[model samples]
Target chain A: MDLFEYQGKQYFARFGIPISKGGVADTVDQAVAQAEESGYPVVVKAQVKVGGRGKAGGVKLANDADEVRTHAGNILGLDIKGHVVKRLWVEHASDIEREYYASFTLDRSAKKHLGMLSAEGGVEIEEVAVTNPDAIALIHIDPVDGLSLDTARSWVDRAGLDEPARAQTAELLVKLYTCYTEGDCDLAEINPLILTPDGRVHALDAKVTLDDNAAYRHPEWDEFAGSDVEDERETRAKERGLNYIGLDGSVGIIANGAGLAMSTLDVVNQCGGSAANFLDIGGGANADVMAAALEVINSDPAVRSILVNIFGGITRVDEVANGVLEALERVHISSPIVLRLDGTNAIAGREILADHLSDRLVAEPTMLDAARRAVALAGGQS
Target chain B: MSIFVDENTKVVVQGISPTSQGLYHGLRNRAYGTHVVAGTNPKRGGEEIEGIPIFATVAEAVEATGANASFISVPPKFAADAIIEAAAAGVPFVVCITEGIPAQDEALAYNRLVREFAGTRLLGPNCPGIISPGRCNIGITSGDIALPGGPVGIVSRSGTLTYQALHELSQQGVGQTTCVGIGGDPVPGTSFIDCLGAFEADPDTRAIMMIGEIGGSAEEEAAEFIATSVAKPVVSYVAGVTAPPGRKMGHAGAIISGSKGTAQAKMDALAAAGVTVALNPTEAGEAMVDIVRKLG
Candidate 1:
């Protein structure tokens, strides 16, 4: 649900937010062309979902077309935070008289929409929060009342903005809130919203996180389908229509519920085993989803062993057991499996699994026993 | 006595038609003292679902059956509306079993429901729902996890984990007052802190078992509450210790974003506040029981 920088800029533009005009370039030649089109003094930014790109040399200021080509070539295949710089956004550089930070996101504590404004905006918001929490003005707006001009003005003033800048800042806050709600963004941040020497404010950068569940309502995202930016394991899982995310651990988990899957991951680490990934096949503990989940976990080389935990209530335990057996038969896997099955038809389910799994399946009476066995089979740290 | 549901609770199903996945099993839920007053599906109105009357609207169902709660098994897209309808109809509790309700929709639904009906309690959108031992089990979670009458009050973000944790507790001869899956959406209809507050006040709950994950400030908030209000022995664990940054682990809400919401941070916070930290799910029961015994 996180949009790359280029996509964020595009979305911002659609919302009438002013972003320095930029063009996405795939190759060195395209970057050079884009820089030339923008007429020198351009910023070449890597279009990745990660931060710290500037420090990683994924961002470069190009004075001329040649510099743009060089920087773009170097950054194109560069990896920063596990995301390759496959594309760059070549934008006309702006002259900043001052930089300010502004973002709108959900504040769970306040249990309302929150807008943050900082006088020192060009740096990481984390630094701002830690170093000078007071420098950042945090305002919570009731969803029903919405953000008003007066409230926005007070927030701007609280951020220590000058009177003239306060008016613009207030206006900008209202616009940003509109963009957040209407655009369905979980996070809409414009770091370093610049005030040009001419006294005009513009969004220099746009970071957006659109709700993924809203994708069905936006058919326009169809063109964004098959985006090559995702990790290979994620891409493969996506193709198989299974919910999968890769992690950096040795124990792979396959659970039926989201909450349980996360708990499984936590337990694995608590037991001195790191989880390689989080996989939830939902309520369908049947053979198809389980098989798909196993295949996805098997694709990760970091996974040394697999854990299958099911608390079948509406879902039949026997069905999940059959699915596990089906997955083992369909996919060639070398890792060991530790399974805990309970609930309706659990005895029958365990019987079915016992018949098929024999020695390969490590079944335990309780969750703790199962986790211990799985960790031990995978060569526990202690 | 159980917390949320019991033999006298009248339950209504949002999707009661044969087309739904758990309609037949919902009938079995009736045997546990769930009245199953009515099933809602406009298309199947006036028909009988497992002999339970079907109604077109939640209002009609609630009025006719005096249903205090609802169990929704509708598809994801329509689930939020069904929840809103249930709230409008004045159902005291609504348990939505549908998964993948859009986060925005959930946010909207939760905000509206909590704002409009302060008395109403909602369990899940992509969850297995809530169960109150012998009182009534409206969710799809297994029955064995419930031990007729237990003193432990459980609040979890995951349905399966809730059952697993309780099953472990039940095996140790620990009973539960009630077990609730608050759901795993980024914006849950009910939160762990909210349920923890209720569990803290319930005399039947001698100990509290909380399962959380790496997202938002829910765990941190719970920690603050536990530090201030909760007098009972609290045994807790936070999942997603190894979840990668940026990627949401399984659950939409189960991601370790910055430094604050990590499992390590949550565990540290809980431990600092005198809550026993279960190193893993396997150890949750023993840790909780030991804490309870020590408190006693």
Candidate 2:
């Protein structure tokens, strides 16, 4: 769940972090109106999830309404790293005396929440890390203890921030940490934590990644869900409660687990067939779930043959076989299905399917054999 | 002779009830010769599920049954608290089988486990729990495919892949000593290195098979550990070579971010560490067979 710059700013403002007044606009007229409300000299920034918006010319300084309209018109459809900008964030431009970088993210190896602060900002932090490592201050904070003001002040000092900006930056870091933990975010970053010539400090840009698992607690996250661009097949699969990813091939793949599903795709390619999609039924291979999965895969006209590969663990192969039978009866599938069953109760499951085998439905014993059969059915010579 | 669990390991089941997954797996574990001593459910205190008495708290269950390990199957919302309670109750090893726990909650729970319960090792909050074949079967892994006192030790990040590898090994008549699924979450309790170290120390375990996927540097770190510390023959298979970038592939941890956490990177690291990198699941099993034969 990556947030647009406007949404990230709104999220940060909830925690008392100061951000420039901004309005999101989808049209040139709306961008001009927003510039008027913010009193001109605005930054019409393209709202995309990808980085390097400025480098891609998706960001421009608008001194007046005419400039805002021109910038907005150019940036609205601009593509940065394959993401077409559909929205523009109009914010009052800031007068910055200095720029600094601050971010909070989980360090997987250290098993702690990592906070990075650097006096250098506005450029790639990775470049700073490689060239002058000492310019950045890295702190690993235990989630239980959290970020204390004392620790934050020391971190700011270690980063060699200016003396006058130290207190306000530390105060803002504490609030940002609150927004990170309390806001249920995987990452809360404020690039170019700007210091005004008047000695005021505030966040200039926000990049936040919210944790999807924490959606149960935050009902407001539905807005973010609404903005997600989903493929039709992916949307249908989500409605059916199946884990699916659409691909560009002829063989539709269905497996039991994530790893097995991925391996299924690889093996399908190995057997001289490309996979049309990756669908994992998970531990639930019941009748209703299987029917829904089959319907979703069958809806894809690109699929020439379906591969049902099940390696049962706690999930019984007999139950999955019964589900496959029930699903075959429910859905009017156009493509042939190649089934491979193994693990617990696999023998009985295969026996149940023996009576139902036909030209459209075939059963193979090993995964390799099933993949080969499915590839052959998909018009590939295996 | 086995790692993590054996005949001597007494188990306490948390979130056990007639309808809970805990009760279901707890009974199966007991059937596999594990000592299913007690259960804990605050509302169902003094009640019994399949003849196992339910206590009000983990401390009571631990005290009464002398349980050292805990199997947690509570819902995601209550999973962190359940783990905290088990760790606080002095359980040396806690395996949480619950998925979808908030990452923040897991972070706090991990901190508490490290600071308060220093000796306790949490296996997973979204994993198929550990299994010592014919000794103790914990969590949802089907125990029938694994054979006790076998020469191979298996560690995996995915559940069904573990089952597939186990099935292939069993079909080839190469049994296992202990099989551990470290889960597929971004932040797992036990790591590949942790399990690899245990397998390296166990004398009954002659060879090791590791299954990993794209995501995180845990596999890379484990490869480093295998190069320096482990002397046993190690075979590895990493999934998601055909997977696209920046997509979560069913598992929360199986996503490729930027250039890191790719299957190729992990395989390269393992191969550099002197591990046999298998191209597919069957190849991984065959690699294990070849290693076991050489050891014999």
Candidate 3:
């Protein structure tokens, strides 16, 4: 659901928002050609789906095609936040007159479409909101209606945008909202809705996150899924349709439901343990989903201990136990497992688990006890 | 009396007919005690699924069956409009089970129904809906998780976690009054604070089990509300305690953007408000039961 910066810019360009002319290059030769196409004074940015790329040295500016080739070769295989740079976005450098931030997203509390505009751009909006809340103008739009030009203008003006830039910023803001709604974006932001020296407003940087649920409507999403960029564990998990997200920790957690998975991670942390990943088997912890989840977790080298926390209802606890047993037999698990099974058919689930009791599998009767056992085992303190 | 829904509630099904979701609803409703008044599908209007009459619109269905509440099983794109139609037709409560409604549409529906109409209450656009044990199982949540006679009040941000929490409570012989999944969407129709206030006012609810997640200030608001408004013993568990900042996990509300909505912050706020914070979901059940027994 997250778009790389280049793709975001491409999407913005469709709405008449000016972006530094850029094209994605796959190989070193292609990148050299792209740099030449864009001419000198181009920025070659590593196409990784994470932030702080600049700080990570993934973004480089080149004076000529020779420097472009050097930087492109260095960045192509470079890793940023565990994601390898396979492609680079080659863009013409920009001269900024002023920098500002504008974003549109749904605000849950107000239950309305909210737009955030700030004169302070090129920095995290959260910082602006915290350090100087007044520096940003927050506008709530009636979802049934839409963001209006008048409201958008007022918002830009309130954020202290100069009159000449205010009209252009307001015009760009409405276009961004239109793009957001039409593109099915959960978030469409221009961190620096830049103004050039020529009095022209352009999106210097585009960051768009399309709503995953809305993918059904946007059939073109399959092309932009970026399966190759995802981690091996996540890729495999996605193939099996299991909800798995990798984290940096030692304990691997498999819990029913997203909340419980997250809660399991919380419990592990509270007990002095950190979870390596979050795997939610959703409502039904059937054999296939459970097996897929376990396979995904077991694939992670960082995982030292596994925690299977199930509060069974529609998903039978006994079934989940059987699935765990099945997954263990199929996969070569290097870590110890702490099991917590409760709710409907919990007694049966425990009975099934008890039947196959081993040193590797420790069945805890309660969540607290399970968490403690899992944390200790992961930390090698058990 | 239970919170949100109880045994006395009459239920109507929206978008129920020959569809796959309708068939599932038919089988589930037959097992649960929800008074099946009418099912609505234009193509199959006047038809009966397991003896529940199908009507064309929410207005006709409510008028014909005298239904005050509706269970919406429509597709995601149309789900919001369905809730709006039900609300406009004077249905006080509409539980939308349609998953994956866009955050924008969900926001639009919630603003119009709950904020605009005083009589209307919306549960979810992507949730399992509400379930009242021994009375009526109106939503998609499993009935086996409920006890016929219990007093614990449950509210959660995730549907599966609600069931998970209920399973834990049922295992401990800690009966519950009603369990509500307010939906994990950024623009859920209901909120934990709203559910908590209802549970606090309910005489039958001996204790409260609140399940929260990182993201937004909902948990903090709940803690603030609990600090002064609620008298019942509240045992809480917040997800994403160890979640990395700004990462979007599976649940919509489990994103930890910064220092604002970490699980630790929510836990701290709840603890400061005198609510018992369960380190894990499993302990949440046992903790609530123990608190109620001690308070009693």
Candidate 4:
């Protein structure tokens, strides 16, 4: 749920955090029009989720309409860390007298919301944290009490931010905290909380990661959902309510749990077969869910054989076996399926599956043996 | 004695509505010898569910039944509040079985549990819970797979993986003192280190088995703790070695961001810390059996 630069800025603005006026552009003409609206001397920034956009030449200063068109044209299709730029954020360039850093994220160890304010900014914060840890003022915010204005001011002062910029920076930090909490963001970071010569402070860049679990509370997130570049198989699986990740291999894997599903993939590789996808049916191995999972995996032409690995805990293996049998009757699966059933009622489940064994359908006792059988059936040496 | 819950532990079930899964599991746990004392539901206060009294709040339930531990099975939205209520009620331990709670809410609940209710130990908001074999089962893990008063101690981040490891160990005639599923959330209530420390202190536990996945530095941190603090034989298994980066495998916390929280990193750290890093669950079980037998 990483936000594009423009979207991040928009999210920041929702909390009344001051951000430079910006518009998203998909074309050179649109970039030029955005430059006209925001006035000249704009920054044509590539909108990608990856870092180091400036290092990859995806960001450039455009002093005029011609410069905006040239820079936007160059950045629109630019690739930064494997993310191809499809959108440009045209923003009015800021005059910075000083740069500072501010970010809010959860510190898992501390079990608190961590707020970091540093006098040094615009460069990699990790380097700053390593070289001069004292330069960064790290504050652990109580989620119940949150960040108080006085505490924020003290944090700004402790970070050694300029005296004139302290009040505004603290104010903005409070707003950013609000944006982080109320906005349901996992992370809210401003890489250069810049101070102008006129003593005005504003956020130069915004990097936000939204919480996917909080989507039910915010209906407006549908716009962000629409922008996701998902694989066709992944999209179809999502529609079917199956957790599936498409990979580049021949053996389609399905398991009961997340850890087991991943282990299934690793064991498939260990037994001389690469997994075509990672699919976790979760706790529900009922008929409807299994049929949907089979249809999604069956739709993948790269899959030569399917591996159904079920280690039922709360999920009964006998019920899962019946679901698989029922799904087999419903879905027209092209690939062979090697089933491994274990845990609660696994013996009963395997006995039921023994009657359905064929060239296209098989069953194994252990996960390792099942993986080997699946690899062999997929034409790999096991 | 077991780490968290044993035969003497009195339990209160929170969020026990008619259709609540916690109510169903609570009854099952009570049937299995866990002291199921009371239940809590704001609307159904003063009512009795299967002969267990229902109170308006955790505090009332605790006061009425003298329950020291809480089993929360509420929906995600009310989970954090339920934990808070349990903690405020002077419950020493809370096992939250609700999943899909917003990370922020969990963060707040965790902080409050630590800062305000310092004596309270929260097990999970997304976990399967803890079990002490024949003693008492506090959470959702199947009680049949475990054997009481065994020599081995188990801790894990994944629910089914923990169950699988326990099943494997049980099949090999290895029993456990206690098994704790700390849950696989970014901000868990109890940590690997917390459970490790408990297992280290418990005299009944001889060897320990840890199951970790690719996500967070909890496993790595636990390895660091085990290297210096823990004197017991430790066998470990890390899942998601073949998982691709940047995608959350299954658990909310099981994601590989950049080069950190990789399965290789966790395994290497544990191996360097003198832990027997097993390739799979069965291998881990075998390693545990070997350690326990050597100890004997």
Best by lDDT: 2
Tens digit per residue, CA lDDT, model 2, A1-382: 8888899999999899999987999999999999988876899999988888999999999998889988999999887987889999999999999999999988888889999999998778888988999888999999999999999999999999999899999999999999999999989999989999999999989999998888999998888774655468888998887899988999999999998999888888888899999899998899999999999999999999999999988788999999999998888999999999998899999999999999999999888899999999999988
Fnat values, candidates in order: 0.65, 0.75, 0.67, 0.66
Score chain A of model 4 by TM-score against the reference chain A: 0.93
Error of 1 at B287 (Å): 3.4
* Candidate 2: residue A80 lDDT (0-100): 90
Q: What TM-score does candidate 3 get on C-alpha atoms?
A: 0.92
What lDDT score belongs to each candidate, Candidate 1 first? 0.80, 0.91, 0.82, 0.90
Top candidate on TM-score is: 2
Which parts of model 4 are misplaced by more than 4 Å?
A77-82, A131-134
lDDT of 2 at A252: 94
- Please state the Cα-based DockQ of model 2 relative to the true two-chain complex: 0.77
Worst 10 residues of 1 chain B by lDDT: B19-28
Per-residue lDDT of candidate 3, residues A1-382 (tens digit) = 7898888998888887778877999888898888888877999999888878999999999988788889999999998988999989998888788889999987766777888998889898888888999999888888777888998877887899866688888888889999888788989999888878888788877889888878888787787885443667788888888788888889999987777778788778778888888888876787778777877888899998899888775677889889888888878788888899877688888888887888798999876788889989887444
Instruction: List TM-score per model, in order.
Output: 0.93, 0.96, 0.92, 0.95
- Model 1 over residues A190-249: C-alpha lDDT tens digits? 998888888888898888888777777777666656764367888888887877777777
Please give, for residues B262-293, the per-residue lDDT of candidate 2 as tens digits.
99999999999999999898989988898888
- Structure candidate 1, residue pairs in collision: A259-B158, A287-A323, B6-B135, B150-B175, B150-B176
